[model samples]
Target: MKKKLLVFTGSPRPDSNSAILAREAARAAREAGASVEVINLSRLRLNPCRACDRCRDRGPGQCVQKDDMKKIYPRLKEAGAIILAHPVYWFTINAQTKLFLDRWYAFGGDEYQCFKNKKIGLILTYADQDVFTSGAVNALRAYQDIFNYLGAEISEMVYTTAAGPGRIKKNKPVLKEAYTLGKKLVS
Candidate 1:
């Protein structure tokens, strides 16, 4: 059976570089015979976690909020691999992305094992003229730290720089890298 992969783009703007990178990877994964789905956070109405500890005390890994997140939980459970795609925003993920990550606490804390053994990848884009100062790697590492605690193995991390409002469209090499990474994931 083909692997089920979920790609979540943390960029608030649809079709932004972060999402473009994810599309490349998802396209490659599909070409390689993996079933893929990409969730654009910009369009989702996900509320921030209230930290009431209700999921731990009253429910089975369910959040109290009634929103688009209810549709996402099942997808997370069904995915064999999960990809978090985002642009480097002030050395970290977007505010909504940070909120989404924080909301994962509803999974009965870090030891819930829902994400254990899952493969993950990171795709980041940035506009820093200097590659070293772009902070993409640092931002990616921040994501890894959370996934690490959840026992999710990061299969790969892809970065693209000098991407600002369609600038990445001129960089075919990086796009190819994204596509190749996706293809390799399922091959």
Candidate 2:
């Protein structure tokens, strides 16, 4: 069976550098024979977890709020791999991405073990020249730590610095790296 990849674009901008990179990766994944779905979180109305302890007690299939997140839960469980594409927001993922990650609590403890076996990728674009900068590396490392805690494999991490709007398009190496990462997901 072909692997399924779910990409979450955490940029609020419609055609921003983050989304562009994610689009390129999705295209590459499709070309490499993996089914891909890129979700624009900006357009979705996702709510933050209420810290109600509802998921922990009620468990497994229940989240108290009935919002757009209902649509994402199934996809989360179904995806063989997941990619998070976001611009460096103060050296980390945007608030929107963090919100979604927190809601993963809805998937339950042991029942959500499906996520443990999945592969995860991180694609981060920043507006400053920070290749040697610790900020971007720290952000990626935090994500890697989370995935590691969840038992997910860190498939790859692609980072581009000083990228804004159309600037990423001019960087062939970064784009190729995204494409290569996508191709790796299928292998």
Candidate 3:
């Protein structure tokens, strides 16, 4: 069976570096025979999780609020692999990304282990040349913890440092790496 990859871009700017990289990766994934779907969080109307523990009472995968996230839930559950592409802000993920992730609470609870055994990939872009020294490392670690808790395995993580919009295009190595990661996902 062909693999299905669901990619989420957390950058608000349509032309942001992170978005570019994500598009490139998605293209490569398509070329490698995987079906790909890219969702830009900036264009969606996703709200943050209220933490009301309503999911538990509703029996998992249930959110009280009906928003754009309702569209994403089914895709997420059906995907064989998931990719998160975002630009680092203040040494962490952007607000849009955080809000989307927090809403995953609806998928929590023992009954909804739908995320288990799924593969995850991360593509992060930052302004600082040394991401480890720029506090972005913590953001990467946070993602790791979240995926681990969800019973998903991280197959690849690609990080690059570029300041201006579309500057990531100048980094050939990173672009190549992103493409390679995508191709690997279907292999």
State which candidate has the highest TM-score: 3
Candidate 1: residue 82 Cα off by (Å): 1.0
- Checking candidate 1 for backbone clashes, the offending pairs are none
lDDT of 3 by residue, 55-150 (tens): 888866678889998888888888999889998888888788988999888887764488898888899989898988766798899988998888
TM-score of each predicted structure versus truth: 0.91, 0.93, 0.95
| Local distance difference test values of all predictions, in order | 0.79, 0.82, 0.86
Pick by lDDT: 1 or 2, better one: 2
lDDT per residue as tens, model 1, 46-150: 888898888886554588889888888878877888888877778767776777777678786446578888888888888886545887667776777888788
Angstrom error at residue 169, model 3: 1.3
Candidate 1 Cα errors over 4 Å, as ranges = none
lDDT of 2 by residue, 1-187 (tens): 9899999999887558877778888899999889899998878998899978777777664688898898898888889999999877876778888888988878754656868779887888887786446377767878877887778898988988745577888888889888888878767
Q: Which stretches of candidate 2 lie over 4 Å from their true place?
A: 132-134
**Distance (Å) between predicted and true CA of 66, model 2?**
1.2
Find the 10 residues in a row with the least total lDDT in model 2.
Answer: 130-139
